[model samples]
Target: MQSIERAFDLLELMADAGGEVALSELAETSGLPLPTIHRIMRTLVSSGYARQQPSRRYSLGPRLIRLGETASRSLGSWARPYLAELTEATGETSNMAVLDGDQVVYVAQVPSQHSMRMFTEVGRRVDAHATAVGKAVLADLAADSVAQLLERSGMRAQTERTITSVGAMQDELARIREQGYAVDDGEREVGVRCYAVALPGAPAGAAISISGPEGRMTRMSTDTLVPLMQRLAEKLAAELRTASHGA
Candidate 1:
């Protein structure tokens, strides 16, 4: 048990250092003796779960990707039915995305039924600042974290409606949080509008969105759609919460 705790402490220390740790740094961070850390690091490196850099620092290795893939698969499987229901209700594209760094990566999507629909492939990645789902999740984060993410993302305008100023984006996020949903308003792509609702208790950066062409989505009354969307979101959220508890 003590060995396991030491190993986890070392891993956390390395993660906190942005994925790399020198032997001395690891020992200092974990409060473990140098010899103990060296032995654990040797085992971790030999198992391909950690790698030694040319500078002799250790970092997370490719084995973590397999664990990430497994988690992503579980997330997608749990979200699929909700995505289908969303597509059926709105006749628009429905997507489930999780924030990755400063980007929102589409893990699953239910394509629109219309002949002329906005098509985004699964596994596509978009700037978090440019997408409704991205904003919905970002709104839940702290102001400092949001600022850091924006700085990392570098606001690149994708369309005429994209929010270009940090002040403007902050104001928009405030509104999104107040309304319990986020709107794209043709921000990410010309003639495209998106509406997103964040799922509470989700792993950070998780959100769901429905998107369609502005002509159709903009013309629809929010009074009519908002209630329906909220209901669906509630149901989806409940299911996700239940599944998470069971897991």
Candidate 2:
């Protein structure tokens, strides 16, 4: 158990560094002895989970791709039916996204039947402060973490409606938390509007959203969208819980 914990700690340290670290730095950052870190690194490298660079630095290796693929598949499978239901009901693009640091990455999506629908490919990432799904998930995070993420993300505006001020964003997040979902009124794109709800479970960063043009989205009130989004989130949560139990 201790060995596993130590190994995970080392891997986390490397991940926090955006995937690479020097041997000495890894030991220092992980608070493990150099010899111990070296031994574990060797084991990880041998197993293809970590790689040693030409400069003797360490980074995540090819085996981590297998793990990532597994995770993506699990998330996608869990979200597929829910996204489909949402799309069918709303006739809008429905997407499942998760916070990846300061960005929201689309993990799964169900496209709209309309010919002129929003185009968001799976695996595409967008600024947290500028998107509904991003804000919805961010509102669930700690305030300090939110601040740190905003600082890291630079508060860049994707459109005229995008929130560029940290204070304004904080106020907006507070409202989103109170309302139980987030709304982007053409914030990320000129005519796109979105409504999002955060998923509750192991990966707290997960979120589900419905997006369409402002002409359609603006006609609906938050009271209307919130209930639908909450119900969908609950359904997804229930599915994830069942899957976990089965696993």
Candidate 3:
């Protein structure tokens, strides 16, 4: 059990350092002796979870991709019922997304009964600056962290409404913080608008959103929908916490 914990700690330390680190860096950060760290890393490398670079730096290996994708799919499946409930209540497409690196990846969705409703593919990755879910999650992060993320992923305009400047994004995030939700006003797509709220206690940065055409979304009363979304997010977070505890 101790070895397992140590291995995971090293992996997380490497991830925190942007997926690669020197052996000494892991020792310094983890306070583990060099020999112990080396033994654990060797086990991870042999098990295909980590790789040693030519520079002798350790990096996460490609094998973890399969594990990550499968876990994401499982999470999406588990959240579908919640998203379906949101869609049924709002009469719009509902989606759950998580912050992945500097992008927001859609993990689950329940399309509206309306034939012309908004729809996003489950695995689709969108720039954080352009989506309501992205903004909702980013709003919870520190200003410096948000700036670093934006600097890593350039704020390219997806539509005329997209916030392109860091100052403007900070302002938008401030508004989201004040309002308790975020809105994508034709930002990601020319005619689509979305409303999102951050999940209260997700293991990672996550948000749920309701999206539709500009006309329908604009006509909806945010005063009514935002609170409903917030309640659902809290409920979902509670369930996730329970499950994690059980595990």
Question: After superposition, which runs of candidate 2 have C-alpha atoms over 4 Å from their true positions?
Answer: 13-38, 51-58
- Indicate the residue-level lDDT of 117 in model 1: 88
Say which candidate scores most in lDDT.
Answer: 3
Tens digit of per-residue lDDT, candidate 1, span 1-247: 9888887678766754657769998877677789999999888889888899999999987897687677777777877888898889888888888876567878778898899887888778899888999999889888877886787678899998888777888999999888888899888898899988887766446888888989999886667666666676667667777876887
Q: RMSD of each candidate?
A: 3.7, 2.9, 2.4
Q: Model 2: which ten-residue window has the lowest total lDDT?
A: 11-20
Tens-place lDDT per residue, model 2, 1-247, is 9888888888867765657889989877788899999999999999998999999999988998777667766898889998898888788999998765457788899999898898798888899999999999889878877886788789998888889988899999999988788888998899998999999764447889999988987886776667887888988887877877888
Over 184-247, each residue of candidate 3 has an lDDT whose tens digit, in order, gives: 9999899999999999878778999999999999999988999899998988878877877888
Shift in Å, residue 129, candidate 2? 2.2
User: If both were scored by TM-score, which would come out higher, candidate 1 or candidate 3?
Assistant: 3
C-alpha lDDT score of every prediction, in listed order: 0.81, 0.85, 0.90
lDDT of 2: 0.85
